[model samples]
Target: MTQSKSIAILIADDDAEDRMLLREAMEENHLPNELFFVENGEELMDFLCHRGNYADKEGYPLPGLILLDLNMPKKDGREALKEIKEDVNLKHIPVVVLTTSKAEEDILKTYDLGVSSFITKPVTFASLVEMIKTLADYWFDLVELPKNPKL
Candidate 1:
């Protein structure tokens, strides 16, 4: 199924270079969905809960998908994933863990915390673009995501 163009994607990552690469990869894939970024998990929660700088709900619509990094400062992805799964309003959003770590513990932990999918960051830019394309195809064209109610 083709997803709505307005369905935003929220990405939580601390490394600026990684975020830039991800953005470039997404651009290479020519994804139609809107993309938003947060420096850390704190900002991610703020965006999701409409707190602090994210108070304007219209300006920051709830995302249909979230790409989270595991080892961010000031509340990591694991904590954020737990909170997202626990919250009734946010639990429906599909969260995919995209990080550099390949530790089995992190993988198992994130899965236990209710992450939809976990992908290790690819080493090459070309690979990243391919990964992004596959991800977009699966999430935006294949899967049926729940419609989020306007806040």
Candidate 2:
């Protein structure tokens, strides 16, 4: 595993338990990352653009990858995704929908919005660990992530 530069993972989820469980799974997978948390799409964008409370670069690192949930407060993932993909500055950052939504329409819409990948969240912690490992392997190890200028 690459150890020099820790990757940043931005996760937007309303559920606190889900966030804790996901963090535990990430720990189990031994994924070297700096995890950023946002409870809603609006916060996610604030973090991304370094606006408002997220303005400090030291406090909010730009995400190397984003794990987005479809349902959120303020702005939903659908709106946030469209905005991100449409903006050249934000579009370069890869987005992966890690959502609980199994709806085909949601899936199709997200893909059309230009998500790099999508995975439905599993029920079990062990399963989540496996999925996280696979995601890490594919995105961090296998795929050549976009080269974004460091903030």
Candidate 3:
């Protein structure tokens, strides 16, 4: 499969275990895209806006896609998602919700907040590997993302 090596992926999840698992899954899938992680929604926003420690754009390049979790400390995914969608500079980047919550309300809410897709976290490691592979294929290989002038 053709991979977009230049496009990085940012994941916002409070759970360290989940982040490690996702990294493992991505490694298993052999995706060429660089993966970055943030433990909270606030950090995610900082990374996106290039504030605080993320001020160096070369060190923390803007992600082409974002995988966000619903529950987080300091600023939940919903709030962060709203802020991202409202910002003209960030709205173009696709944000996907990959959370464990199967609540219909969360699904509807995220979509309304301009999330590209909402996916329930897979239960098994094997399933996660498959999901990561599919996600990489769809976003990097199939989809045509907008060129960020800022980058």
Q: What lDDT would each prediction earn against the true structure?
A: 0.93, 0.88, 0.93
Please provide, for model 1 over 32-125, each residue's C-alpha lDDT reduced to its tens digit, 9 standing for 90 to 100: 8788999888999999999999999989999999999999999999999999999999999999999999999999999998999999999999
Worst ten-residue run, lDDT, model 1?
1-10
Tens-digit lDDT track for model 2 on 1-151? 6631567899988889999998999889877698989999999999999999999988787888999999988999989999999977889888999889999999999999999887899998889999998888888888777766766
Which residue window of length 10 is worst by lDDT in model 2?
1-10
List candidate 1 segments past 4 Å from native.
none
lDDT by residue for model 3 (1-151), tens: 5646888899999999999999999989888888899989899999999999999999999998999999999999999999999999999999999999999999999999999999999999999999998888898889988877564
Q: How does each model score on TM-score?
A: 0.97, 0.95, 0.97
Give the C-alpha miss distance for residue 79 in model 2, angstroms.
Answer: 0.7
lDDT of 1: 0.93
C-alpha positional error of residue 151 in candidate 2 after TM-score superposition, expressed in Å: 4.8
